[model samples]
Structure formats: structure tokens, C-alpha cells
Target chain A: MNDPAGAPALSEIAIKPLKHVNGAAHRWVAFIVMVAFFALAPTFIYPVFLMKVMCFALFACAFNLLLGYVGLLSFGHAMFLGIAGYAAAYVAKEGLNIEAIRLGTIHIPLNIALPPFTPELAILTGVLAAAILGYVAGLLAIRRQGIYFAMITLALAQMVYFFCLQAPFTGGEDGIQAVPRGKLFGVIDLSDVKAMYATVFVIFIGGFLVIFRIIHSPFGQVMKAIRENEPRATSLGYDTDRYKLIAFVLSATLAGLAGATNALVFQLAALNAVHWTMSGEVVLMTLVGGLGTVFGPVVGVLAVLGMENYLAQLGAWVTIVQGAIFVICVLTFRRGIVGELARWIKKPL
Target chain B: MTDDYVLETRELTKEFKGFVAVNKVNLKVRRGTIHALIGPNGAGKTTCFNLLTQFLPPTRGRIFYKAKEITGSKPSAIARMGLVRSFQISAVFPHLSVLENVRLALQRKRGGSFDFWRSERILNALDDRARELIASVGLSEFEQTIAVELPYGRKRALEIATTLALDPEVMLLDEPTAGMTHEDVGRISALIRRVAQNRTVLMVEHNLSVVADLCDHITVLARGEILAEGDYATVSRNPEVVQAYMGKGYA
Candidate 1:
């Protein structure tokens, strides 16, 4: 059948992905099972720790949406993470309330004021702000090639870092501490650790599912096409730059969602989350899991953060251990843990 | 319909610093005719194609497709106007399967190009048309094969099929047979003739035999200017055209 003795008639070709019922059904099953695991995991493990993993997993997945799908690299993605964190914290705690920002010795009393926001609204504000910033930054990053990715990323990173540090509502270097979990949607009291965990879990699962949907969509096909070879895509009438920018913005928005959730969960939005190193950390997480695979980033978050949690007793030796694990993983399963698994299973995941 | 030409260039010129790549060359591709742009190395044949496609903007020129001025149009905009092109290198999306590679072009037929939220399975509606195109190009057997895994000659075939899926009224092929094997060349030449039955073709070709066999009109370029333009017999008989483009072996 593979031999081309004669061409198959127009009606002869059988539809594949659409009709591949087992793969589609199994994928849904896998998703449901994942939801069950996360739902039940808090019973056996610390809710806060799991929340941390979910936040990072969501962030890594968002980053992967750009890096893996569209072949874009955001060197300063931490800007999105940090900016969103600040926005969420600011909205939740102050909501345009310009109290005072302490800079070393000077205290600047600010009069900027707006009504306080609900938790979900605060998160929405962060995500939207991130999306806007991503759009501006993405405008500067060329659609094809990684040469501009580093340049644009660094520029945005510096600008965002300063904004996060100096903004009066952000509490400067101290960040917005003791942010009230507040009532989620004027109903659920997130002060309960389990309730907070559930909210964060919802965010993680939602972001993960969205990213998954985008990748498997027709939009995803074009993104992959651009990634495979952009010139070809351009020739085929695709406004490649627009697609890339949209992908970049979407990636940043999701990352913002993660950061906003993290800020709420810990009741703190620190300057550290917005720092350049945070961006580097997300890249590491995604690479460790699998750069392009769907579950790769989540798996990577599990490995990296889990190792940190489990190896804290070793202190400085943990770095050595972590470095060794990364080295071994790179040498052995270069495609990443989930990437290698996806390959073994012969699935697009 | 006012002009006999489907695609035309008026004084199309491109320069790299002080050196001129394409020097005020006028090109007219008649509708429903196979037009070939033949030239030697560095004769600006590819540059001319690039300018016509707006991939490389000309220093000074005007391009007209279907009698409308398209000088300021973007490469994609021009492509959207039914003037599609193939690259000197095979231009199919390498990681996508042949079916997908073709279906992507067909996706343009249905609107909502940026519908990121919808499932790609909806694109399955286009599989039949994509398969028909694949079969037309003798690639029905490789519909599921990843483009990168295809044999070199077959990759070009896949590209043609992908290009055809765009449903262009005018096709620009930049050395469609570049670096192809002799047998592959013969196969692609016949394929080109077959596909060009209805559409106008403007091609930059190195192979003289293919130009003579398939092209109704030939334009010879050398040192960034048109050396000659006519039927194959007339152009090949020109001593200057032979010396500049065809070489002594052909003469």
C-alpha cells in the first residue's frame, strides 16, 4: 500500500486524527485521571507544596506554549511572572490605593486610589496586564529567528523589574506582604488552605487545558508550521508576525495567571518572582520536562521543585545533586522526561 | 483582462549597496502561457523572482498582477491575490505530514484563519480536497509521510502539491528543478507541464531542455538585465543569449 504504483482516488483517503477514537478517548481519560490525582493529592501531601508545584507547572506550561510550539524564546519571561504577581497583589491588597513606597531611607506617601478588588478580579487584572505587556514586548521581537528573543526579553525584563521594585503599591523590594486571600467570587473563603489549593488547582488545570487546546487546534498547526520553517509559512499567506505575537501574548498571560495565583497562595508577592532568575528557572523547568511536549513542563516542575523540597536537608549539596540530575537527564533523555515518554508511547503529547 | 499579461514588472530593480542585482528589468508574463526566466549564475534571475514576489523589495519598480498595481503589497498580500511561489529550496513544512502540509494551504479557503480556539479536527473537512491534490501530484501514497522524510525529488513534488493547494491563478516557481536528479528532473518537468495547463507560470530555470520543452515564452537574463526574450528557438539562436546564458555547449 505504501508503494505508489498508482495514485489513490480522491475518495480513497481515510480521515485519521478525527476518526482515531482511541487516542482522543484515552486522552480524555488521562485528563480526568490527572484531575482526580490533583484533587486527592492534598490528602496525602502538603496542600501548599502542591499549590507551589501547580503554580510553577502552569508557568512552565505557558512558557512552553511559546518556546515549543511557535519556536519563540522569552529570555525575560519573569517580567510577566513578576508584573502579574505585583498586579494581583496590588489589586487584592490596595486596588489603586497609592499608600506609600519605602526606598531605602525615603518614604513616598502616594494618593493614587481605586476600589479594592475580589481575588478572581485581581487575578484577571494581572493576566490582562501581562497580556498587554507581552503584546508590547512581542511587537519588538521578530517573528522568525531567536536573535531578537534575547534582546527584546532583556529589554522588557529590565523595564518590568524597575516597575515592580518602585511601584508604590508593590511595597518596593519588600513586595506586597500579607495580601488578603479574600473571598473568591464573594463566596469561597480562600483563607482555608484547602480552599486556596483548590483555586490554584483550578487555575493550573484551566491553563494547562487551554494551552493543550491551543496546541491541538488549527492555530497550533500554523504555529508548528512556522516553527518548522517560517519562510514556507509566510509564502503560504500567513501573517507570521501576527501569529507569533499572539502566541507570545498568550504565553505571557498564562504565565501571569500562574504568578498571580502564586502571590495569592503565599499571601505575598515578592520581588524575587519577577527577577530575571525566575525567567531562567521557568526555562530550566520546561527544558527538563520536554521543551515541546504538552505534559513535559508540568512533569519538569514536579521533578525540579520536588527535588528542592526533598533535598532541602542537603543545603548546598542540593545544587550539586540537582546539577547531577540535570546532567544525567540531558545525557540520557535529551528530549526531556515527558518528551522521551511521549516518544516511547508514540503520541503527540 | 485589459493587458495580455497576468503578471508584469515595470523597471524592476534591486541593488546591494553599490552593486546592482536586478537592473531596471521589465518582465511581462502573458496569461495562460508558461513563461521561463533562464540565466546563468549571478545573472539576477532569482533576485528578479524575489522582487516580483516582494520577498525582497526592489530599489525602484512597480509590479502588476492581473492589471492592478501591487508594488506596495506585502509578499503575503500578493500571494493572497492568487500569485503564489515556490522557493529554490523545497518549501514544504518539513515536520508536517504530506496531508497536513497540503491541508494547511487549503485552510485559507475557509475564513477565520486565526481561529485558535477551535479544534483542528474541523480541518478534517478539507481532507478530501487535500487528498485529491496529493493524488493529482502522484503523492497519494505518501500522504501520511512527514515531509522531511520524503525523498529529495518527492519533496519537490510535495511542494508543488502544497503550492497547488493555494489555488493560485499565477504560479511563480524559483528553479523548481534545482539540484534534482536527472530522472527526478524529468518527473518534475512533466508535473510542471501538467499543472500549468490552466495557470500562468513564471519560472526561473537553469535547465535549458525544460525551458524549451515546457515554456511558451523565454526571457534570458545576464549581469542583471534581459539579454533576450522570445520562443526557445529564437532565444537559443541569439549569439549573445547563448554566450551570456545558454553557454557554448548549448550553442
Candidate 2:
């Protein structure tokens, strides 16, 4: 076997091993189960609370897309979420109306009026705004690595927070309050709680699937490669920075979608949405759910929100309880709830 | 100006602050030959290798691959031109399976679209060729194992397989047989020889025996400069070469 002088014939080599089956089947099964559970949940539980959970769940998933897959810990993701909330609120309230004029002898009274902005259009505008902001922030933030990257993003997010605080359109302390939920595509009235809950659930599932698809795609494989060994990926002819930037922008846009949906559900976009505390909460949710697992974020958001709802009477003890849970998760189950469950099942959840 | 040489460096130098790691040195690796860059520790063999591979920009000098200047190109850009380098440390994607690693390398060769929306099942087309490469590197059994879970020798083998998947015209291996058992070294040396039949190989190897057996030409560096250059027999016989190794307290 250690024949140094003579080259071994390729024919003598052993047969190639069978490819390992991926966890795709398990993931899809889990997704179906979760969707079914949610569909039935509103019948028993409060629809509004469930919608809130779905919103945060989507946010956590978006944040995990970068943290788990790309190995980037963005400490300012709330900026995207908050900014998108503001954008959606503003658009839904103001109704995006563009004036059209014909220059000539006669001016026709034809105004391109798109008044009474729909929920779908507002959400799209919010996502677009988030994408544009992500591009600008990601460009500056990706210049650093590890802690410095975190700090840079945090600093950028703080600047945005202050801008929101001072900006007239944001309404400063009060925020853009009482935003109209409006209609979905100018037909379905979102004012109805059931309709609103259904819309949010659909948005959450759609965003979740997109993230899942991204994680399983070729681009995702390369992103994982970059995460594992960036220099190796670079040597393999991948522009690592470009891939990272793309992941970052995508994560931000999804977070924005979650934020927009949250605004529509609550009928308000406020300072709490854009605050650094919200960013930390998303991280905590993702961590508790499992960093890389597909369904981990959903479970994590549910647990956290469930505790908050149940422990409202406990006052400061809620924070202490959250801290205790985080510590326990880190020490006993470092992989988070879904991660540990996935490990037990011997499948990638 | 000659096309016979696949890679050439002119006055390649790298300085970290005031201390020069790689002094101004010219290296010419002829096409389709196993060229070894051998030297004692701190001889700047790795530094020179890094310079040529675009891992580190040269403080001063120019690099030419196939007579085209690629002095300040990015590592990936250089790799696209069929000049790829393997890391001294096994640089395989740790979490990915061996087959997946090879497929990833092959995907780079294909230069496919950056469509993140498409299913990864599309990459299955490269499986047949990836399996061939794995078998060639004697890693057929470990094709489905995560790269990080493989034993040391197998990890190195997987790294080689991944590198080979690139179909590089000129391959640069940094200490390809470093930290290997005697048997692993022998097998890899033979593998390197087989692989170099059509492609040029520029390697920084510490195992002189492997170099003597596989390399067609050798460049000996000492104190960040070329001490001797020739075939192994010629360079090994040179008193200066012996003295440099002996000065480093090696017999």
C-alpha cells in the first residue's frame, strides 16, 4: 500500500461509498407538522398572541440565516426590523400617491393616485427599504470580523436609532401610532382579526420556506464552506466577501418583512421595535431555538413569548427567568432546544 | 517571455515591518514538471509560495503565470486562471462531506450562476467525476464522511482530491506531506507524481525523500534567498545545500 516509487493504478481503488441522505425529508415533515399545528392553534389560543409569536419567529429565522450559516453575529439587525416597521407604517398610513402631469397646451387632470395603500404593497416597500439599507450598512460593516464586526453594526444601528428618534416622520417618542392594517391586495380586509392572523401566518411560512430553501441551495453550501474555512473558499475561487454581503442583505430583508408584518398586526410602529434590546432579544430567541436548525427559531420564539405572556405578573422576575433559561440552555444544552431534539432524532431539523 | 515556464516570479519580496521574510528572488517553474521548493526552517519557502499564489501581496516584484502578469490579482482570480494553491494546514470545509467538498471545488471550475434559489440537487451531476477524484486519492471509503471527522491522513487526501477537482493547469501545494506518517508520505508522493503527469506542480515540501523521488526540479532556499537550484541529485550534492541543512542542525 505504501508503494512510493510506482504510481498505484486507479482501478485498484475501492468502490465509492453511497451518498449520505440529507435531512431534507425530515425538514419538510417538520414544516408540515408546524403549519398544521398553527392552523389549528387559533381555534384554542388567542389569534393576536399567535400572530405576534409568528412575527418574532420570522425575525429570529432571518437573524439565524446570517449567524448560523454565515458565522456572522450581527448586533444591529433590529435596525432593519425597526426601519421596515416604520416604512410599512408610513406607507400604509400615507398611501403612496404619485402625481402625474402632462406638459403642453392642455393639462389633463390625470393623477396617478394609489391612495389607501394596501398591506401587500406596504410590506413590499418595507422589504425594499430594508434591502437598500442592508446594502449600505453591509458594505461598511463587513470590513471587520468577529467582535469588530459586531461593534461596527451596533454603532451603525445606534446612529439609525437616533435618526429615528429625531426624525419628524417617525413621530419621535410616540412613533407612527395607529397605522391602518389596510387590505391585502385591495380585496381582503386585514381589519378582521382572523384575516390578519391568517395573513401573518402566511407571511411567516413564506419567509420560513425562503430561508429553508436558501439554506439547502448551492449558494448556501458555499456560504457554509465560507463559514467553515473562509481562506479555503477564497483559494477555491469564491469571492467570499460578495457571498457574505449577499447573505447579510438577504437576512436584513427578511427581518424587514417580519417587522412590516408585526406593524400591520399591532397597528403601531414604535421605538421599542428599533431599539438595541430588540436585537438582543432576537439573538436570544435564535440561540434558544438553535442557531442553525430550521424549526429552532419558531420553537424558541414561542417559548420566550409564552414565558413573557404568562410571567407578566412577576414583574422583574421575568428578566431573571429569561436569563436563567439562557444560562441553562448554554450549560446543559448548548445546541438549543430544537438542536438537541434534532440530535436525539439523528436528523438535521 | 518563454512559454515553457508555467509560473515565474521576478524579485519577489515580502517584509513584515523591518524583518524581511522573503527576500527578492526569481523562481521559474517549467510547465508540466513537479517543481519542489525546499529549504530549512525560516528559509521563506512558505512566504515565497504565498507570494506566487496571491495569498500575500509581494512587497516588491511581479508574478507571471503563462507569460501573463498576475502581480496583484486576488487569490480567487488567480485560481480561476488555473493556478490553485493547497494550504499547509488541511483546508477542507470541515462540516461538508468529502464528496460535497470535491463537488464544491468542481462547481468553481464550472463557474455556474450564483442562483441561491435553485436546488442543490443540481450539483449531483458532478458526483461521478467527484467520485473518480476521491478514488484516485484513495479516499473512496470516506466520501460521505464529514471532512473534519476524517483521520489526519485521510483529511489530507480529501484536501488533495478537492484541489484536483479544480482541474488546475498549475497546482501549488504548501508542505503537501507535512505531519504525515511515513506510509502516508509515500502514498501522497506517488499520488503527486501521478497527478503531475499532465499539470505542473509547484510544492513547498519538507520531506526531501519525497522530493527526490517525485520532483523533476528543485529550488533550495536559505535565509530568504536561493542557495541552490537543480535536480535533487545535483542540489543534494552541493556543499552549500548540505551546509544550510547542517547549519540548521540536521544531518
Candidate 3:
């Protein structure tokens, strides 16, 4: 294993697909096609379903930034997702509450309220909150590498899960519901379905573009160099740990971006966004789509969400079906759909 | 602490699990000289090399570069100070392209390693010098190939190219010709001599021919202790050197 950060769970050699891939023009063409597809698809598909996929796609890409580029597999990324969603929802709806944080028999009472914010402000608030949390968590987590890194993140996320369950502002099991979409910049009404769809579309494309830019930038080049050979990077005078932390914080901010937008799309924020299972789902999306490729997660979202949509009638069996499909994906296309395709075409997707 | 020598080690020692890999030894390389550390396997030549670079911490020792104590400095910090080393085993970024490997070596001096917003075209500027380095190492044909995909000797050449890209004040070559063919050894020896004109070079080599041909000073180690230190002619004449090195060289 060349990576000093520690070996990945799936040794890169077994799953390494894209080797002779350099598709600059093809990548741009694909991006344009993606923009067109998403813009036109909602006209035919249900708007909310499209919006959900877009949000999750953004979430998966942000998670992929850490896992794919930096080679840091965070198993606890959902805390960022859920925290931003809760923050956005809380800010969107003005509310008051009196509750006590319980520690066995000990209690600390909390009373809080806030004036409602516009949808954009609420989402920005969510993103800012996630960035701070990510910075703190990144500081603690980067001390360990590889599987230990994953485990530490998982442990920290569990703490967040419990906090959401006990926090006064969170509204407990019910979550903050019916968060008013309000208006975008106090003019474009988010209450309208098309307007909300446009907003989610812009956010997703913007994030996806940012991820693409980072992958190609000078900083991103050094980042890939670190992921490939950390000691060698250090030998060339790079502070690799610092780069890892920055990538972590950026990924967290992007995940928060997705979460905040997703909450607005549904007009609700709940524990589902923050659950460990949500973290698992993002991993699955990144893996099945292509662990490192740019477009992998978007296609991955479509597959996962499509399965859920068609299989919802199966109730509890959905988990079994999703698991079985993941097994097949791991067996058949471990490089993922985009990854294998990139290998075949000799172009980076 | 004299300014004459570019690098000096003060009683450098290392132990692993009660086994002394490198015992207390003092070493110095004068400015603009090729120094050789020639020893048989397990004489701790590589361990000594690692200790000087601080890649492996010395269990009990201190290292100085230009009279400044750098005993506990980070490997990257040591690199930034213009003290650079190549690996005993070729250690280029395996997945990175040949152009990329050399460019990365050229990257650190310019700073802004955190410029995520800038275009990658900024790095393309470094590629010309990277190509020149690659060509000097006779790896121009493998310019686009990943370092791992290159043949073993070619990978070593890539490693050398990256090392040269730094243009360091001091160069440490750990078995530079370890995997190369006869012709490559001559080529690399010439390259080393050319690069060593202005800078200091400290090498750990098993090849007696390279040590005799290029080094200005030779230090022979046996059982992690210096057995001889002088010019090649002087060191070769020592009975201990003949017994320790030549006896094992033939074996």
C-alpha cells in the first residue's frame, strides 16, 4: 500500500480501474449533458423525486471528496448532513421551547427562540454550522489514519445523534416540520415547486462544479499525490496532514450544503438525516457510482433512489434488497459504474 | 560546529528492541564533496541515512545541518531546508505520472499548495523543467506513464529525476544504482558527479566501483561502527576494510 494514511478497506489494486484516463473535453461534454438531463428530467419525472435525488447526489459527492481524493473514509459524515438540516429547519421556522438536558438524574434547563429567516439565510446558517463542527471533528479525527480514522468519525457522529435526540431546539422525535421555504433573496418564492426545483438544481450543479474544480486544481494535485504516497509527498516538502484536514472541512461544508437544501425541498428536518444509516447510504452511493470519479455519485443516487421508489411496497424488505444489490455491485463492478466505464473508454468520467 | 562542513552528526545512535542497528558514530561531509558510506548488509548504512534525514528518529543522537541542530525536525521541514534524499528503494509517487512526479518536486518552493481555486494550468508551467529532469535521467519516453508502470530501473531514474528537481544544497542518494544495469550505473555516476559540483552528496552504496569512481571521501562501517575513514586508496589499504568489505563483497 503506497498510501501512508493507511490502506483502504478495499485494497486499491483490486478495485483500481481508471489508469490511462484523461478526458478534458469529454468531461465538459458530459457535464453539459448532465445539466441538460437534470433540467429536462423534472418536466417528465415528479419534481420532488428529482429534487430529493439532486440533494442526495450533492451529499454523496461531498462525502466522496474525502473518501476518493484524500483516501479518508469517514463513516460518520451524517452528523454534518443532519446538523445542517436541523439548523436550516430551525432557522426557517420561528419557535420557542423549554426543556432540560438530562444526564441521569441531573438536568440543565434551556429556553430558546429565534425569528424566522429566509430560505437562503437559513441554508447559509446551516452551512456555517456544519463547517465549524467539521473543523472541530477534523482536528480530533486527523490524529488517526485509515480504519482508525473511520472509527473515530463514527464514534463522534454517534455523539451528535444522541444530542439531536436530547436537544431542546431539535423538537426530539418529531423534528422541526413544515419549515417554510419562504422566499429566495426575499423575491423568488420557494413555496412554488418549480422555484424550489430551480434552487436545488443550481445548488447541486454549483457543488458538483466546485468538486470538479478542486479535483483539477494545483492543491488537488498535491492532495492526490498525498493519497498516493504520503511519505513521498512529505519528502517533497508537503505538509500532508494539513491538506487532509482542509479536505475534511471542505467535504463537511459541502455535505451541509446538500442537507440544508434537502430540508427545504421537503419542508422538514428530521433524525433520518443525522442517523448513522444515512452515513452508510452516502458511502454506498459513492461506491456504487464510482468511488473517485466526478459523475459517479449522481448516477449512484439515481440507482439507489430508483430502487427505493420501486421497492417501497416491500416495506422492511427494502433493506434486504438494497443490501443484496450492493453485494452484486461490489462483486460485479467494484470500480463502480462510472469507474468501470472510465476504464473501458480510457477517459476520466 | 565549524562552518566548513555542510552537515554533521554528533554521536548518532539507534536501537531496535535491544538490538543496536547503528551505534554511536560521528560523520561530516565538507561543502562540495561526494561522501560515501560503504558497509555490508546490517552494518546500518541505511539506518544511518534515515537518521540523518530524521525519517526514522534516532533513539539517542543529534544531527546538525550547517551548525543548526535539526534532530527532531519534521521530514517535510528538513526537505524545505534544502537537505533532500532519494530512497534505498525507489520511492516515487507510484500512481502519479512521470511528469507529475517531477512537477511535485518542483512544486513546494513556489508555495500556495492550498490554491484550490486556481487553474491546473498553473502547474503546466512546471512541466517543462520536469521534462528536462526526466530527459536528464533518460526517461523522456516514459513522460506520461505512471511511476509504477515504468520498469524497475526506469522507476529509479524517475526517483532521481524528482530528487534533482529540488536542486538541493545537499543530496543523499541511498543506493542510486541499486536496480540499474551496467550502462545506467555509468550514466548515473556521471549525473551524480555533475550535480555534486556545487552541492554536497552523501551516499550509501554497495557498489565498490561507484564508491571508488565518484566519492571524494569514504567511510567504511562494520557492525555499526566506523572501521576506516579516508580517501579510497587509504581506506582500501586498511586490513580491517579489506577484511570487512572486500571479504563480504566477493561473498
Q: Which digits, one per residue and each the tens of the lDDT, describe model 2 over residues B112-212?
A: 43678987778788899999999999988877776767888788888888889888999999998999998888888888888989999999999888899
TM-score of each: 0.92, 0.93, 0.90
The residue ranges of model 1 lying beyond 4 angstroms of the native Cα positions read A1-20, A98-113, B245-251
**Which candidate order results from sorting by TM-score in descending order?**
2, 1, 3
Local accuracy of candidate 3 as per-residue lDDT tens digits, A240-345: 8899889999999999999999999898989999999999999998888888778989999988998898789999898899899899888777778887777677
Steric clash pairs (candidate 1) = none
Selected candidate, larger DockQ, 1 vs 3: 1
lDDT (CA) per prediction: 0.84, 0.86, 0.86
The 10-residue segment with the lowest total lDDT in model 2 chain B: B107-116
| 1 versus 2: better lDDT goes to | 2
lDDT of 1 by residue, B153-205 (tens): 99999999999999899999999998989999999999999999999999999
Better of 1 and 2 by DockQ: 1
lDDT of 3 at A338: 81
Top of the candidates by DockQ = 1
Q: lDDT tens digits, residues B62-84, model 3?
A: 89999999999998889889999
Where does model 2 sit among the CAPRI classes?
Answer: acceptable
Alpha carbon lDDT of residue B26, candidate 1? 91
Better of 2 and 3 by TM-score: 2
